[model samples]
Target: MIEADRISKTYARGVYALRDLSLRIDKGDFVFLTGPSGAGKSTLLRLLLRRDVPSEGQLIVGGRNLAELTPRQVQAYRRSLGFVFQDFKLLQNKTVLQNVALVPRVLGMPPSQQQRRTFQVLKWVGLQHRMSAYPLELSGGEQQRVAIARAIVNDPVIILADEPTGNLDPDLSLEIMNLFREINARGTTVVVATHDRELIRRVGRRSVTLNHGQIAELA
Candidate 1:
């Protein structure tokens, strides 16, 4: 479970990114976080990722308070969560298999298991055939699939995606959304921060809308 209780983030000059906002996302939930530019969607996501702490109040995930976690705990916490970004942050020099396999290798999994798990996720994302190809050689949609495979390679309990489909065409965007649905169906909590209202409408899932650093609507 993820919970935010009266959290606020303030920048210099009294600028507020979030203001005493509170929310809870239960495990296995698929939620859409929607708002306009400068509406604090990214700020909330960053706080959930523990990249930034709130100026006031507590953010809790999986029964632990984020603000109180030690550095080692923070690292461990991050490893258990998946994050996908608008720009596919791929290592240009790495091949698809190598990129996805990097996580298990870093976690010290046996090399054979690393290869097996990497191959599993790549095939899950329908990228097994492109495993030997570099990021530069793939199309935008294929690159995004590679990124998704990388994110889920570790089998995280939660997935956080920020504007994941922003760069894709309508058809490709729909495909990616369906892929996320499949991931969510497998029981990973999914939080998607996006500006795509049509996607939200089609999914018909619960949505939280923020404005001027506060939640304006949630349904």
Candidate 2:
């Protein structure tokens, strides 16, 4: 679960990115954060990822308060989370298999286990057949699937996606959203920040719409 307790993020010169916002997302929930650019969507996501701490209040994920974690605790906490981006950040030089296997390898999973896990997730995302392909060699949609595979390689408890369909066409965006829905069905919490209203309506998940750094609407 994610709980933002009246959190506020103040940027340079006291600009408020998030202003005393509070929210709760339960486990296994799939929620969309939609708003205009700079509506504090990304800022809230950054705080949830612990990339940036709130200027005031707290963020708690799975009962852990982000503000009080030790550095090592922070790293461990992050391990339980997955993040996807608007841009597929796969290493250009790496094969699809290598890219998906990265996190397991980094954690010193034995090479054999890493290969198994990588193959498993790649199959999960329907990219098992593209294992030998490089990022540039794949289509845009395929690259995004590879990115999704990489993100879920750890079997994270929560999946946080930032504009995941921003670069895809309408059809491809729906395909990606379907994949997310499947992931959510398996019980991982999913939070997506996107600007596509049509996509949001199609997904028809509960939504939180922000305006000027506050919760302006909920649907």
| Top of the candidates by lDDT | 2
Per-residue accuracy of model 1 over 163-198 as CA lDDT, tens digit each: 999899878988888888899999999999998989
Error of 1 at 218 (Å): 0.8
Runs off by more than 4 Å, candidate 1: none
Q: lDDT by residue for model 2 over 32-115, one digit each (tens)?
A: 999999999999999988998999998999998999899999899889998999998989999999998989999889999999
List per-prediction Cα lDDT, in the order shown. 0.93, 0.93
Instruction: Quote the lDDT for 85 in model 1.
Output: 89
List ranges where model 2 is wrong by over 4 Å: none
TM-score of each: 0.98, 0.98
| Alpha-carbon lDDT of model 1 | 0.93
